[model samples]
Target: MKYQEFFSITIEHSYFSGGPADLIVYPEEKTRKLLEKQGFLLKRTGTGIKVLLPMRDNNRVFPVLTADDLFAFHVLPTSGTVREFTDISEIEEDNMILFTNEGLDIGTIELIKSETVKEEVFQNFPALAKIEIKGNQITTDVIGTPPVYKAIFDSKSIKWKYYLLSKSGATDIAVETRGDQLQFNELEIGNNSLDPIITSLRLNFPDTKIAVFESSVAIPLSSKSIKDIKLIQRDSVTQTDSILMKHLPNPSIYDQGIQIIKIK
Candidate 1:
């Protein structure tokens, strides 16, 4: 035995407006075959339907079906202009239009539009040359005579690094550089005091934000808090922090306590 699920069906009709002359009923597979024998073709895709029909003067295609009262008709061409069919019970008359044939050829339209935009941009900016897109970075090379201008694709690269560190659950620290600035979200200290860490960081970065967090209440060395050090409270430090801080500048601690100090 097979179980069957009951479902309701809703019919949709194509019409420009709710008018007495715009009522249409689409043909079923059998009816479509009968119409095809008389000289009409129906093309259907996953999304839409198309109908092709012949006329007295020339052939025409209607992409939509229309209903008029108790009669259904396809759009046809009149003279050189296309118009909707108003006659009913004339399925043998080739007047219906298929949507698949009337709509803009999507592939060709996209190609043309893309080409047009590229050409327009190139023409407007004569200096524009090659464009390179990598992940979130976009680099565009501009044509120049002697001096080439290389610009950083994104200035937010530095800001994104902080977000990445936070997501990775990594301890953030501020490391001063000779030319570059190292910023972190959290830092861990070992046997050393916070004062030395600040001193070392300031010697390097001179301007950087370093935040520190520890599990226990560690007393920081007796010195003015640097402008770049920030201390917070954490439950504990991982072994990695302890090992890595050894190579870090000025990683000294006076005692175990919560201290937020900035080294400048």
Candidate 2:
């Protein structure tokens, strides 16, 4: 029933490559008791110990102990002989160290970065979020009944809007649609200028029908071909009244943006 039992950790010999770990060990009852006494709740899941430590600003979560931390403990056998240990306490301030049950230093856990968390969120919940990168702007949409969109357009400009699309950039050709309104800036284009953009949109949404409208001009598209085009307008609405609704689709568009959107 402990948190560690709910989760598991595996140490690999190589990261980003396929290699088995030299040693793989799990927390014993004694180790769990020690961590529990220190206010760490352990949950046992199929993956490994889900160790929930008290939230501290500097604390981080790592799935495995690192080689550097292992060096300090000096791997010793179950026998009486002791192994030579390295003095890593001097660099301890720069690293986070974790110990193994056998009294050996396993490794230092690396700090979890924001990018890593974003990737994890996308990978694990691919249907619930949308990740988009255009030029220097990074936009994410966590769409549902009450959709939430987070955008990091620039390091200095970070904003979140609820049910509204905001515009930026010169000429404001970059259009974002939210709620019941579509907004754009400096909209001046002819057939040639809109063709590539419409083609890109068709390429992005191959499964859905695309209709581009500019004033009284409406172009219904069924194929992926770009010819003469000017201004382009793109919008998506989920069809809720289709006879094939069950087989219609899942939220897969966000995967193109490296995000996942989960709707409850």
Largest lDDT belongs to which candidate? 1
Off by over 4 Å in 2: 1-42, 45-48, 52-111, 114-189, 197-251, 254-264
- lDDT of each candidate versus the true structure: 0.26, 0.25
Per-residue CA lDDT of model 2 for 141-189, tens digit only, reads: 2321111111111111111111111122111112233331323233343
Q: Residue-wise lDDT of candidate 1 within 72-184, one digit each (tens)?
A: 12221112210121212222232221221112232221101011111111212211111111111111124211111111110001111110112223343433323323334
- On TM-score, the candidate that comes out on top is 2
lDDT of 1: 0.26
- The worst-scoring run of ten residues by lDDT in candidate 2 lies at 152-161
Please report how far candidate 1 places residue 260 from its true position, in Å: 37
Candidate 2, position 218, lDDT: 18
Clashes (candidate 2)? 35
Error of 2 at 74 (Å): 23
Per-prediction TM-score to the true structure, in the order listed = 0.15, 0.19
